[model samples]
Target: MASNRPAPEAPYVPNDPDFGGYDEQTWEEWNPTEESVRPVRGRHRVHKKGGGGLARSSTVLGVGVIAAVGAGGIATAQDGKPPVSISLPDLGAVADSLPEAKSLPGVGALISDDSAGSPADAVTAAAPLTAAGVSSADAEQGTTDAGEALRARIMRQAENQQHQADDAVRTAAEEAAVKKAAEEATAQQKAAEQKAEAKAAAKKKKEEEARKAKAEAERLAKLAKSFAIPTSSYTLTSHFGDAGSMWSSGHHTGLDFAAPTGTPLKAVHTGTVKEAGWAGAYGYRTVLELEDGTEIWYCHQSSMNVSAGQKVSTGDVIGRVGATGNVTGPHLHMEVHTSGGANIDPLAWLQGKGLNP
Candidate 1:
């Protein structure tokens, strides 16, 4: 029957070298069947039970004995100490009273399910007994090892990710450099092409200008053949810009062609006679306007051959040379004006038109 009374405590003895040695006389030499042996009264004895509640207690107690023996054996070997006998708990009465294994995050996860008997369960076994005996330090070291392994794995993963990121960045930079180089090369090539084109264009234009000048010289040479000098066999008395008081502007303004009276004067170029009469110091004068609006003045003329508005070709007789316009001697005073009425050196002008005079 079940009873509220507590189970009797089992007796255990510890081996001590300081004490008297074990009693070998009380061992197999003691004959319990002899009269000399007697049972002690009121002493509780442990009996093996094959059935009922006592059987459950005996099985639990057996497991506790096996655990203690295994642990003690290991502890005794490492410490070189004598064996220690331990009393087992009353599992039948307080089986649930024992504490449960901890369930902390990593710690709980490491606890292998012994019922499964898997290969991984082997790793969850207890640590070897130390001379100091089994302690929480060994378990903590196991936990720390597990944590360190996890930490190492995470660090490696992070490092790999960093390497991948670095590689990607490097790749991007290289690609950008290649692209920039390609663009720069393209720009340089385009600039070179443009420069070459400009150089070729400038060269072509210069050559064309030279060819036109040559062609113009050829045409002007043929035209010069049709031209003639005004009043040939005349003496060159004075040139344009001779510094003398004989002129009004402190310089001679026209060329003086000294000749006999009534010398036939001719037009220098093909033009229309714009003026057949003139006044003042010039006795008789004529003004011829060329097609390009340049004016040629025939001054100090004794007589005029062409009237106003008369068309005349080069070398056509238009007037006569005479000493008429405040002249020191008989001569024709000829002058030239540009289209804008600017008087330039007539010798240079005639040379430009393919004439020697």
Candidate 2:
């Protein structure tokens, strides 16, 4: 090899140091000329798919599932259904096709979110639609019809209550007035009865007093008539019995009343005249008989004024005094006798009536 070998130009060194005896060296150990260090182009190797791709796919799938569940929850709250994928372009069409929710009475204040579950809830909640300020005209008209009807019902209820209250007040007032009137009437009646009773009692008392006064007057008049004096002015001259030489019956049998020759002789009691004539030794005499059968005789009278059978009352002058019959002077003789002809003393009878004889 040495005789024919030409000079060794370079050694065959492999890129893999372990495959050949070439020493492993850096670029500085294998320094070459600029033309030899030129970069060479070749087919590039593609990288193998790694676990990161799988992890990224899993993350996207998880996010999608979470989004689906969240949509389903909202759908369930609104329409009681699972969520469905919907394109944005289809939303407007579906919303427009949905029917309007029916309104309820006394439910105007209920908000859309307050519903338990309904398809309209989703649409209503999005805008938070409420019945406030919204005209209930359509709903109310469908149910009750006119506005006047509702107003009339409310007014009628109020009027009925007011009428009841007024009736109660009127009844109470009437009862009170009736009670007051009854009480007043009862009081007036009682007062009138008392007044009538008092008047009756006074009338009876006055009648009794008048009766007693009349009886007393009559009694006094009868007493005066029984024992009246025979003359207003006279003097006692001769005793009832005198024993003297000038005597007719040996003793005076009657009392003597002396006065002027023409003194009046009055009746002693109410009587009728029995005699008014002259008699022997008893000139100008008058006799009177009372209702009790007693007799009064006036003797020795100057004159007689009463005739026979004439009615005379007490104090009637029946004769005049004179010196006649057996009298010694101008005097009148007066005698009283019982029905049996028994003579009684006139002076003693007059003294019994509290009168001077």
Candidate 3:
């Protein structure tokens, strides 16, 4: 693993050619004894609180034993040889055999002056380690021995970032769902409003049409009260504008009402008699002129009841139906003329006064 540690300083060298200037106070001389270096059943040692009084020399001997065991195990594995017994070499006599602290392969940082201390000193420290490499943000959570604390901080940071990402995704999804719901609600409201408007419009049109129909019915009722059909119990034989070779004119110019010879012909409306006796093919005819100067002519009559200069009211008998001059059967030939003397269909004129036939 990569570690945040500086290089070590040179090991102490003595002025004497064979041995260094070892001070009794600065450096403690440690020797490996058989009892101190005895192997436990397991790889670990569990010390009791007070009576476990292992000496510092014993701790050093344990480290040396571990190193020797590791080296021996490797050599045995490589040579396909049987496992060899681990034995502590004499450090005082074979001191030159030790590798330089700076040149030690992987443990160079452990013995460095800038590091915490030697392995034994570090393990024996009283206080828990501080969060050295951890940031203040992570350290605020808690502290432990160096490696564990750093590992915990890294795990917490990753979890926190993951939580933040999950929160962002959830927030975006919620916002989108809300927006979609609002849009759908708005569209529904618009559709409902349009439906209401269309319904109102259709209702208004229906009401207007009903009102116009009622007014027209009232007008027709009033016309019916003031006018009358010229004759009753008659079948309509022919309409005006019928084309044939039956008369002087190429087209018939009168509305023919076929009835019995003595069917009474009434005045169509309140009018003055303009001409009563016809001299030609109109036979016994009577002409009535309304106050508006529109003329109504009743021809092909058996006899006339009203004379010239006489006033007549609606439904008054004016003549009798007959088969007279130029007539094939007993009928009343009725003609209408506008105030401007333009000939018009009598049936249409009757309809204008609210008559159906």
Top TM-score prediction, candidate number: 3
Top candidate by lDDT: 3
Off by over 4 Å in 1: 1-144, 222-226, 231-244, 257-265, 270-295, 300-313, 316-325, 328-331, 337-353
Each model's lDDT comes to 0.65, 0.62, 0.72
* 49-144: candidate 2 lDDT, tens digit per residue: 232121112333343345445444444433334455621111223223433332333332233323345655443333223332333453354423
For model 1, the run of ten residues with the poorest summed lDDT? 25-34
lDDT of 3 by residue, 1-357 (tens): 211122122346456333455422222222334545443322222232234433224444556556565545444433344554545533332233444343333333434344345664443333332433444445456653467677886798999999999999999999999999999999999999999999999999999999998888889889888889999999998998999999788999989999999999999899999999975898988999999999999998899988999999999999999978898899999999989989999898898788887
Per-residue lDDT of 260-316 in model 1, one digit per residue for the tens?
Answer: 998899888898999988657876889989999999888888888999999999889
Comparing 1 with 3 on TM-score, the higher-scoring candidate is: 3
lDDT of 1: 0.65
Cα lDDT of model 3 overall?
0.72
* Deviation in Å, model 2, residue 32 alpha carbon: 99
